[model samples]
Target: MKMTEVSFDIETVPSTIRYYLKNATFYDSSCSDNAKTVFVKGADGAFLKISKKGSLEREYRMSNFLSTHKVAPKVFAYESDLENDYLLSEAVSGEDGTSELYIENPNKLASVFGEYLSMLHSLPTEGCPYKNRTAEELNELTNKEASLNILTEINYSAIDDVIIHGDYCLPNIIMDNFSFKGFIDLGYGGIGDRHYDIYWGIWTLNYNLKTDNYKDIFLDAYGRSKIDRDGLTYFTQLIKLCD
Candidate 1:
């Protein structure tokens, strides 16, 4: 058996892929363009994710946290060097929501997305280490084009904190026949306002489906009788500013 090879985004390519390529498979693309992920189905199955060394710790921490709650993949091992990092974890056992099957069933997909998000947001946050505070978030904003005044101008109502999946998009969600499986790309997850995830969920649906016809369906499924239009606008602006 010969090892298979695949081109990854130029950041961190895995040397182990060459050794295991005969029995392993390579994923050239993922939701994140910044990192590289390769899937290997061995004794139990796993993903070998490679990325820059510094920030991979967050994903490792977050994955461990969620896995404890039975909400994410189980981490197998994590290792790193000065220039690159590696994360090996059990492969999520479901079809990605971005798959054509799910894409065709927008109503079912959106409903499941909303229900799973509700479950996620309901998790306890007392000891959770990650937080997406507004002040901290604003301070991290790097977009010179957006006004800093926008932050000051927005009057935030009392916040309700829950475990927010930072990048709650279609690709990150996994489903098996409309039943929720698990979440991937958890680097951005933390305790944050529900609106942040809501905004991204809506944005992702619109983006991936190439239409804005289903925001209400998702919101309804998420069971928000009182929509926080102001929070939505504010956080959307905040994310845009940061970008």
Candidate 2:
């Protein structure tokens, strides 16, 4: 990781500039030890994210696609060396939902999150080049001993396809004084069930805040028109099994 100068937006000069490494691992949920996030502060006062090689191809692809029509951060540069791949992106400005600012308004937080998720699920997935297939996800759990018992519980009959964030937790979303900003960590993003993300949304809130109060409120705010309660339960159970 050299402190070389880099600029993404301006196209006239086209030269490398150094950036300061901020955080080595922005999130704690990296699926593999080799996969990590490196946050950097650019000379132009922008934030850029760099990730391990071989791990961010999908993220780069999906982020570019989402940035075109949604509130995703802009991609700057994606490169790789011998040991690591790098993805440089403009950071989503503002504090995350996990910050204390939202602590006073958990009800509003849950409702707004529900609406944001609803809008995300409403996006058309046509020509989308990725998918978070159940079978593929299940394979990620095969090595876990607890996953064996839950194997029989896997029901492939239900599917509500949409372009999902894959990991729809609080930290992945950003907000400024309770207003929505944008999304981050699109590594697991693809076409999948809306319930998968919803389950994670509820789980992340409860896990981070240490409360169960907002689950029902969020679900209610999300509306019942397109959600399947049984599907939610099933997907939640599947995630628990993996854990």
Candidate 3:
């Protein structure tokens, strides 16, 4: 996506982050409606995300946790007031997975994507602060006003929990010259079922490439032997309900 240069008054920013805004150009890089993200262009590049108060606490914690594993950006400061929260973090190196250079070659991109996802899932979750996201998500789904009967038919007794990138779509995964760099937007990340990531891996490829051709290539690279078809189907439906 193109980041359009925009005018911003730095005086309105949180005092804790005003030091990073000196003589920096502002770009409107926001992709979500829930928050406003400004890209600070200066000698020391950074991103300033502003949102409702308390909305970013989990993201701040998750980013710090993943940064320790060398897979995410380091947070500079997180300041909150009665009205809003401001998060400042260093900009990660590399273009996101949706870059044209990578999307031009779907096969290679799919393989690299699968390999990196497998690597992420292999990381130990012993110290992870967020746990059992699968159960939490199910609770949310069950509480939804809409009636979803499929939730009753699926048995979640057997689940292979792992550290999952909750939103594993193309825009969230960063790549540097076809090599894995890091992941962004970690608000939903935590200890969850692997199928959550796998389902998104397949969905993103289809959505970005506008075809359903690369699903098997990605599944194969991630090892189909480790995947449970029933689990994948269940999570796919679960996500649809939540959406």
Best by lDDT: 3
Query: Model 3: per-residue lDDT, tens digit, 101-207?
Result: 88999999999899989989988887787998888787776666453567567764436468888899999988888878788888889998999999999999999
* Tens-digit lDDT string for candidate 2 (78-110): 766665566667766676777777767888888
Q: How many backbone clashes are present in model 2?
A: 7
Instruction: Give the C-alpha miss distance for residue 72 in model 1, angstroms.
Output: 0.6
Clashes of 1: 0
Candidate 1 structure quality by residue, lDDT tens digits, 1-243: 112446434234455433343455455444356786776655556777778886678888888899888999998777787787888788877787788888898888888888888889888886666875555566676454356677557776526488888899988887888888898889888888888888899999899788888887889888786457788888888888778
Query: What lDDT does the true structure give each of the candidates?
Result: 0.76, 0.70, 0.87
Q: Which stretches in model 1 have alpha-carbon errors above 4 Å? A: 1-31, 142-146, 158-160
Give every collision pair in model 1. none
Of the pair 1 and 2, which is ahead by TM-score?
1
Return the candidate ranking by TM-score, descending.
3, 1, 2
Can you rank all candidates by lDDT, best first?
A: 3, 1, 2
Error of 1 at 224 (Å): 1.5
User: Which scores better on TM-score, 1 or 3?
Assistant: 3
Return the TM-score for candidate 3, rounded to 2 decimals: 0.94
Residue 67 displacement in candidate 2 (angstroms): 0.7
Model 2 stretches astray by more than 4 angstroms: 1-45, 141-156
Better of 1 and 3 by lDDT: 3
